[model samples]
Target: MFAPGQEQLSKEQIKAGEIQASQTVRSAVAGAIMLYLSPFAVDFVKKFL
Candidate 1:
C-alpha cells in the first residue's frame, strides 16, 4: 500500500512545478518588453541629462 504522506507530497510537487513554469514565462515576457523598450528609454534619459 502507498504511504499516506506520498500522495500529499506528489500534489505539492506538481503545484510547485506549475508555479515555477508560470514565473519563467512571466520573466521571459518582461525581459522581451524591456529589450524592445530600452532604446527609447535611453534616448529619453539622454535628453534630460
Candidate 2:
C-alpha cells in the first residue's frame, strides 16, 4: 500500500539525515583534535624557537 514516490522521499530523507549527522560528528572530532593539539603546538614553538 505504499506509494512509490513516498517511499523514495522517505529514503532520501533518511539519507540526508545520515549525511548531516556525519558532518556534525566530523566537525566535533576536528574541533576536539584541534583543542588537544593546540597546547602541544604552543609548547613546541616556545621550546624550539
Candidate 3:
C-alpha cells in the first residue's frame, strides 16, 4: 500500500506526465502540418503567378 501522502503525489505526477505528452503531440502535429503544406503552397503560388 502507498504511504499516506504518496497517493496524492502519484496522481499529480501522472497528470503532469499526461500534460507533457499532450503538448509534445500538439507541437509535432503542428510541425508536420507546416512541413506538409509548405511544398504544395509554394507550387500553387508558382503556378498562380
Candidate 4:
C-alpha cells in the first residue's frame, strides 16, 4: 500500500500492531465468555447468600 512518498510501518511497528490486535480480540472473547457465564455466577452467589 505504500507508494513512493508514503510512510510505511517498520517491521517492529507492524508486529506491535498485530500483537495489540490479537490482545484486543482475546479480551473481547473473554468478555463475551464471562457474559455468557454470568448466570452461573449469580447462581453461585445465591447458593452461598
Candidate 5:
C-alpha cells in the first residue's frame, strides 16, 4: 500500500543522484581537457600572428 509509494520515491531519488554525479564527472573532464590544451592553442595562434 503506502510502502510501494515510498519505494518509488526512493528509486526516483537514486536516479536523480546518479544523473547528477555523471554530469559532474563530464564537466570535470571537459575542464581538464581545456586546461591541458589551452597553452598549446595559444602558442599556435601566436606563431601565426
Candidate 6:
C-alpha cells in the first residue's frame, strides 16, 4: 500500500523496531511483576518491625 513511490521500511529497520518494542514491553512486564509482588516482600520486612 504505497502511494506513487512511497518506500516501506526495510527488513532491518522493521526488525530493529520490533526488538526495541519487545525490550520495552519486557521491562514493563517485569516492573509490573515486581510491583505486584512488592507487598509480599514488604511483609518480610514488616515482621522485624
Highest lDDT: give the candidate number.
4
- Output the worst ten-in-a-row residue range by lDDT, candidate 3: 1-10
Residue 44 deviation, candidate 4, in Å? 2.1
Count of steric clashes across candidates, in order = 0, 0, 0, 0, 0, 0
What would the per-residue lDDT of candidate 3 be over residues 1-49, giving only the tens digit for each residue? 4676554548888899999999999999999999999999999999999
What are the Cα lDDT values of the candidates? 0.91, 0.91, 0.91, 0.97, 0.90, 0.95
Model 5 Cα displacement at 45 (Å)? Answer: 0.9
For candidate 5, write residues 1-49 as lDDT tens digits: 3665553447788899999999999999999999999999999999999
Off by over 4 Å in 3: 1-9, 44-49
Q: Model 2 over residues 1-49: C-alpha lDDT tens digits?
A: 2765553457788899999999999999999999999999999999999
Provide the global lDDT of candidate 2 against the true structure.
0.91
**lDDT of model 4, residue 17:** 97
Model 4 residue pairs with clashes: none
- The clash number for model 1 is 0
Worst 10 residues of 2 by lDDT: 1-10
Query: Candidate 1's residue-wise lDDT over 1-49, tens digit each?
Result: 2776554447788899999999999999999999999999999999999
Q: Which lDDT tens digits does candidate 6 get at residues 1-49?
A: 4597878889999999999999999999999999999999899899978
| C-alpha RMSD for every candidate | 5.4, 5.3, 4.7, 1.9, 5.6, 2.1
- What does the lDDT come to for candidate 4? 0.97
1-49 per-residue lDDT for model 4 (tens digits): 6588888889999999999999999999999999999999999999999
TM-scores, each model vs. reference: 0.74, 0.72, 0.64, 0.80, 0.78, 0.76
The lDDT of model 1 is 0.91
Candidates 3 and 6, the one with greater lDDT: 6
Where does candidate 4 stray beyond 4 Å?
A: 2-4
Residues forming the 10-long window of minimal summed lDDT in candidate 1: 1-10
